[model samples]
Target: MSQSKPEERLALELSCAICLQLYRDPVALPCGHNYCLGCIQNAASAEDPKSPKRCPECREEYGSLETLPKNFKLSSIVDGFLVATTGGGLRGGPTVPCDQCLDNPLAAVKFCTRCEMSLCPSHLKKHEERHRSLHVLVELPAERDGKRCPVHLKVTEYLCVQERLFLCSDCLMEGSHQHHEVQTFEVAKEEMKRVLEELGKSVSDKLQITEALVKSASEGPTDKAEDKLVARANILQNVQYVFSRFSTEITVSIAV
Candidate 1:
């Protein structure tokens, strides 16, 4: 099979599984899995809090999701990737118009999933007032139709583990998926994002360490054959570590 290009691989590394978009405010769990802070928290909230929390990918059990660490390295990498891909043109890209606007459509600031509409500053203010206590606003392109179950034509919010398919609320209520292991999409995405984030971090760490080691070896004394041999061996070891770490990350990412 053909391998993914460098940019494509990096894009995959930077994306969050929950929203299937670039990560925002990524956080790392104890299991080393990375996820968007809000995504993970929302997934955790759905579970019974009394029980131990499990890592989304590995299913490794851990207590408390109260103090997850922010993955600064991965976040920086994502920012840099965005800059490179956008060619410093992050601002003036094509934009989706406000769905609420009729005559002259304005650039939408946020999308209301509940209302299935994009809102501009003016309309958004009104929406907030009307549904002050209950609203679900998200980034643009929620892909509502894409998220619907093909069989039932309802939103596929649930994942049937046994069948490995996304199911709508109706599927569960109708007993078609009775006794099958299931989880919310939020839960499944959280787990997958966690693993991908951890792998991205691991690869970054290895690259940094390898670069430092190579620099050190280049500057080291090599007057004698013995010293030269040692430096070469050290550089070789660092290169091997970096390659192995990257290989592992690619394998895990592809599997995911």
Candidate 2:
């Protein structure tokens, strides 16, 4: 086998294991590895509903889909690498013309994300004169955080519990969330954990009650409750198994 270059090796590491390709709309797991968002979600949902969501790469368990967060920084890097390496255009193909080169619209060398303009090599050099003023991105497209408050242009930082959606700080004070109940990420996580535990206990308790009721109905002077329970347990075994499995799933999901 041919040895891989350092750049190729790094690309491999960044690529999603599920897709076996460059990360697109990447999401980071608690395990610190990233994968395409759709890929991981599909994988988890494809698993038996009774089982914990396991990381395809590490076998790390997650309690719920809410645990994963998008890796925006890594996504930016992946998009840049893809466009640079694959000659990606505005349409995500080759041969997109540079917007600024009025005399000759050559194939773009870079895309200025802030200005939303493509640039040829000469214009790109001029753009670099104050590169810190704007970001240079690749021509390829990827999912980005568009949930920021349109007016403030900052990320929506709070979940408005009453509205059932996220809101940026500006929106909380001046927009629709002013009178709504809100919660931080930490608070929501704790609340979900409590709810999940309660759900598990409730199901387990109901199952035991059902088991007891079955025994009571069958009990007679000759019938020991213990003996009757043993005889009828197999009849309810499948139902019990389903409940037990569901309880485990609820508990594990909350922990994730």
Candidate 3:
């Protein structure tokens, strides 16, 4: 029994309640329960509207339907762990065990719309039925190679400048040649480099313009200060001239 407990703990630690594989989008319910988004939604929808929506295991009723918020920090940690374990690939579902109990691995997980995590199928179903349109299930496409040419056995070797498509060398010469300008593999690569260089220069020019504008703005205050100083000096000079003229007139009066 002691050994069983440890094994159960390990299993729960690696498994996610919703996806039954691992947690991708983990969410915390108002009842302090954690589940994948899809799993909870499904669980919430399983019962008839006339009945209360409750947790499957605890049977605790949540009277209102509200979409769960995503736990971003937990998701990041889980994603990092999975990536490290799988060599940067999400090959299998989550490896973390459930937090509720150490026994009984999670099973049949689904995606939750509100929570943005995978949920056990039962939980997800319940969420769907109760929340109605609150939760949405998304279908993601599998990763595919976009560079391969389906018609030709060979890899894409040429790009049609006019048609703007990657084509095999044979296809470029035979079928696509009539209307399109064909560029060699090497030439296309060079053109890309040239385009990047031009874009870099354009960005640099814009940055220079921005710098000039900032410099001009900074000079505005200095220009105002210089103008004020010049006006003060002119006023002082006029006062000195008036004093000198008054002294000359007084000296003449005293001599007479």
Candidate 4:
């Protein structure tokens, strides 16, 4: 539980002040603080032009700023942390320590979405008994997103039929896929299942055809190849006998 504090603090720092989301294209300022480049730009733009541009967090002044330095290390670290939390969950080492277990220092198995607290096995059992309709996070919901749209950066709600991918509400409206057919994941599930069933039938038909082909091939003509080889060998033997007789006649005529 003591170690969990640092991880949470790091996550808080990595979040962009403007978007209130994880930093995208993180850039370091002169004030030794990091923010998203777009956030910094917007913040700078909102300020007075006569005075030097000041940082939103620290209020540090910068007279002339052409470019912001990329915080590659911080970005990489944040990305890694997000990856660990979002999908793969904790590995050998535990990040979320149990708040309930004080003396033992046990790792948290599940997180209560309502209480925003981690629980160990024993605590989780108690929590289940006490808290009715409790929602526990087995895995953090894909960075709190099922899957984000590539363009809009919002949670993808629908599957695009023509493109064959997930699309957000914004993407479905204004994007190139507006003309294309789409359906919500709820509806798409049944549609996809129907398509899958059709494909399965097609596959079954093809398999039957292939099986028939294989069976016919096995039964069709086993002796044809052997018969051809035997005929060729017999022709060669007859030709050889004729050649030997011809050679004997030539030898006898030459001797005379």
lDDT per residue for candidate 1 within 45-133, as digits (tens), equals 88888877887778887666667878999888866765565432123344455556543344455689888887654566567768874
Question: Model 4, range 1-256, lDDT digits (tens) per residue?
Answer: 2233455555556667775545666888888888877778888888887878888888987545567788999878766765554332233342454556433323455778877666644455556667655565564333432455656545578877776778888986796888998889888777656655665565566556555654554565667766656655665565556556555644533332
Compared with the true structure, all predictions reach lDDT values of 0.68, 0.65, 0.54, 0.62
Which regions of candidate 4 deviate over 4 angstroms?
A: 1-6, 17-20, 87-137, 140-256
Q: Over the full model, what C-alpha lDDT does candidate 1 score relative to the true structure?
A: 0.68
Query: lDDT tens string, model 3, 1-256?
Result: 1233332343355456555555656776667666776677777787787887786666777655565677777677665554543334333442322112222333323344455443333344445566767677543212121244545433477777776577875686576465778877688777766765665565566556555654554566765876656655665565556556555644533332
Candidate 2, residue 14: lDDT: 65
The local distance difference test score of model 4 is 0.62
Candidate with best lDDT: 1
RMSD of each: 26.3, 21.3, 23.7, 20.0
Q: Clash totals for all models, in order?
A: 3, 2, 50, 0
Tell me, by TM-score, which candidate is best.
4
The count of residue-pair clashes in candidate 2 stands at 2
**Model 2 lDDT per residue over 50-69, tens place:** 98888888899865777688
Model with the higher TM-score, candidate 2 or 3: 2
Alpha-carbon error at 197 in model 2, in Å? 1.2
